[model samples]
Target: MAALTLALDAMGGDNGPSIVIEALARALEQFPQHHFIVVGDDAELAELLAAKKLSNHPRVTVKHASQTVEMTDKPGYSLRAKPDSSMRVALDLVANDEAAACVSAGNTGALMTKAYFALKTLPGVLRPALMSAIPQASGKSAFVLDLGANPVCDSDTLFQFGVMGAVAAREVLGIERPRIALLNMGEEDIKGNDVVKSTAQLFQQSQLLNYIGFIEGDDLFADKADVIVCDGFVGNIALKSCEGLADLLLSNIRSNINAHWLTRWFVKLFYHRLQRSWDWLKPDHYNGASLIGLRGVVIKSHGDANTDAFFSAIQQAVEETQQDLPARIRDRVESVLLEQD
Candidate 1:
């Protein structure tokens, strides 16, 4: 049997080679069948592997990439000036079929730009959208698309996002006939701007999607909608705001616990319970965000991701590759477009 090869950009992210090496080690132990090609300086990667006592792993290999695309570099400039950068090299591996998937914790904008230009989007997909799952109250996750792809989107683009997001929810969340909702300021038909109103009409008229009504920002965590569709501008704001709120809430809870002797004693009494709750709320649980509608599977991790976060992203890429998520999405999106015509 052929081994599943995953190309990783070792020089990307804030933690650099150390996090990549640690992630590689954890992934190797967890999924022995998946091989990795670390694209970066061969000597540095080798040293990191040796430090982790993972240099002798049979499934691991190193590919030398001399250039590094800095986070501050423009996407177009980086792609043109540094063809041999780790990010470019990793995508090239996928483009040439040398690897099944590409995973990176690099600049989010650069990754999306590189993936779209290098690997290309699937037929009928106007632009690729970034999709991530946000945890809800019912132990279920809601899919939000265009998280940071296109800041401005047309109704047609939003309609396409709805179709793609629905297919993703079905494949990843095992939800059949996933309920779709348009993200708006109000639930009323006349509440939003021209875009939202037009989108609502489009969804209402379509038979292909299970169009639930409009959903406000508060509906995100209420489990009122399963699949939330919005333009990248709105989606990105919502995503970042949610992250900030989570951080603030966690900090406040910790501060309160440590403020009083009685509360600190109470926390000690239920330390395991408190710890479990905190663990459940950690961002690492949802580390991978797919650049959906592309021709291949590309997962983008947080720029400041650690070893565990990188490993989680790799695991997501493995699952997506094994499931042929891009192909599945292509089929669904094309079918929807055909029905409309």
Candidate 2:
């Protein structure tokens, strides 16, 4: 992947343009092969960039957007009223081919709504799903999807998510012949609702997918499956639960280290090592989720993402662009369809 341009919604995150510009500074240094076009309130973004000494940087350009999408804005309302908003404008740049991808930490619903309209879904794609790689305790990560994109999904939609997730696992994560699994209450042959049963039948019948059996929520990071498929409702709850658990554990560990003298001494001895391990377990480490199956790359960072998390989202967008993920998913879906025919 040679040099490519990426559009950024500079006003999207909770910390405002300051975090975005700071991340851009780091990205510009780290990914010299990429150019950035940041969309936001021009004056504000310019000042922020100037503070980072990126205003005159050759690899970056600032585009003025009159509006900012708020976290509380309704998805439909944001789309209808904020055409020139930073989030919308950033996506428009992708749609017009002025940028290879867009990265935003804006409202997920608003971003998804605009991206569907702006970039459109790929041919043969029913709906774009939010896919993210969750770090596993087993020393490898697995890809999971439908992370709050569609609360209601039919068997066919879930199957399509399986295909998309597998392609992503293979292309993005370099997992060849990725094992795809349905997230269910149990791994038994007769364990789930009608939709899960139907989706299992579909996956089991598909010769292309490495369809493993169902996995319970406890197995999410067990690395038993390369790609876990679920409806958005389940996925969203599961992911947030994992994040919350991670936060709770981190907080407890820090609070407990000094609660016992022996424990305090032990932690002081291995403090650096334990801290390094704990840092990777944080919610912000890999914060971006790709809105896959779109015509262009769109990475949605957590709305309250810090600089590191936002930068991770930018990296996610770049990796997807480099892999030509849309093309891969589109072609794979075409192949699957033709095979069925």
Candidate 3:
């Protein structure tokens, strides 16, 4: 395959362009074949690039944008007011085909709004969904959709989430014929509100989906379902809860380990093993969440992500780009629509 060039919204994250430049260095070291277009204030980004010795790299170039979309900026305002922002410019690279994908650690709402306008959704997709690989206890990843994109979805939209989530799980998580389920209050057929129940009926009627049935929120990370479909409201709450829980557990574990000399020694001795085991639950390990169903690839990095977390997001963009995820979703969507027709 040919080289993949990713556009970076260098000023989007909390740490600003420095971290992006640092993460780009790490990415280049690991993926020399992948190139980058760093978008931000030319003078500041150039200084950081020079400090990192990336000033003259053949694989990296900087694009100057006069503005940045702030973390607290309203999505609508950013879309309407910030035409020359770094985030907008980076997204333009993808839409213009100058870059294969774009990565941003900006305002989630703003990024989504800008991306929706710049890239649009695939044919037959009512709206794009946010999908991420939620780590499971079974050493597998559960692909969950609408993590925080569309707050309210109809039955048809939910069904489409299932299809798109399944395709993404298969492509990114390597889950063959991924078993799918809708997130609900209970697993019983009679549970959940009308929209979910109607969606379940649609899934059952479809010959294209591998829909299994309804699954509770607990089933999200239990390996009960490879792909969990829910409206953004529920999925977002679940996602935030999971992340907060993981942090709490890790914090408690670290505190206890440091509370005693004996436990500290044991931790040191088994550091690598424990580290490997706990890495699965770390937020940084799964930092990138794709804006799935878009016409082009867009990976959202956490607004406050560190260098390691941002690097992981870059890796995600590379993997999804290699998989040609947008095209795969488009094809599956067309297939389902044809079947329904």
Candidate 4:
């Protein structure tokens, strides 16, 4: 792939610019074809980059922002008061077409607010929903969207999410005719409240999407649906629950592996294979969530992400940018809107 430009919110995460700088260094090595712009307090970012021997790297640029977005800041406050924040500056690079995408491990609400403001929603999109891929049982990936981006979505918005999710799966994950399902209490068409039932009706009416009715929480990773759509309220909880379950499984597996000498010896013998399994289950492996339905690509990383997790976020930005995700979404949304009209 050709070299793509990305902006990094150096001062956004809890661990400071140190982790972001370190991740950039790692990403530079792994993706030698990419260019990166690091946005933050110029002095501090320069110092950190120098420490990592990336101060004068050919593909790296440092941009100065006067402020940082605190984790506790409200979305409205951060959007209104901190225009020069690292988060906002990084987002500006994307808006100005200086960067293909921006990755920020900042406050989710603030990031969403600023990103939606800076990038604007794609035509016909009611809101820019956040989406992240989840590993599936068939070793494929399923996408879940509205991940805390829009807490209260109406039927129209939910229907739009399903369309966007399908387009995302088809473009980004190479899933043709991606099966779309609404996340609900039960799998039956009659299981949900009015909002969900109404959303399902819209999906069923659409010929552009592969509407597969509803799926319960248990089917999240069952590969039953290629695209899972829900409001931010339910989607965020589902995402967190998956992460928590992964942690729990890892913890229990480790505990059992060391509980007996035979088990320990067996693990040691198959350590490499077991390590692959562990790596697959690590939540850090999938740390970036895309703010979809926008005119530009924006990736929201976990606020407390470490170097590896942050690097994964950068990787996601690159992947989405390379796939031209926003354009695909824009085109699909236009198509869906025309279908509705």
What's each prediction's TM-score? 0.94, 0.95, 0.94, 0.93
Model 1 per-residue lDDT tens digits across residues 49-85 = 9998878779998999999888898888887898999
lDDT of 2 by residue, 1-341 (tens): 59999999999878898888988999999998799999998899888888887778999999999999999999999999999999999999999999999999999999999999999999999999998888788878888999988999999899999999999999888999999999999889889999999999888888998998899998988889999999999999988887788778777887788788888889866767877666566543456889999999999988888888889999888998999999999999988777667
Give lDDT for model 1.
0.86
* lDDT comparing candidate 2 with the true structure: 0.90
TM-score of 1: 0.94
- Model with the higher lDDT, candidate 2 or 4: 2
Q: What C-alpha lDDT do the candidate models reach, one value each? A: 0.86, 0.90, 0.90, 0.89
The RMSD of every model to the true structure, in order and in angstroms, is: 2.0, 1.6, 1.8, 2.1
Writing each residue's lDDT as its tens digit, candidate 3 over 211-304 gives 8999887777789898889999998888888778877877788888889999998887765576666666754344688998898999999888
Ranking of all predicted structures according to lDDT, beginning with the best and ending with the worst: 2, 3, 4, 1
List, in order, the clash count of every candidate structure: 0, 0, 0, 0
Q: Give lDDT tens digits, candidate 4, residues 257-331.
A: 889899888986676676677666544344688899887889888888889889999988998898898888888
Q: Candidate 4, which segments miss by more than 4 Å at Cα? A: 254-279, 282-285
Q: Which sections of candidate 1 miss by over 4 Å?
A: 267-286
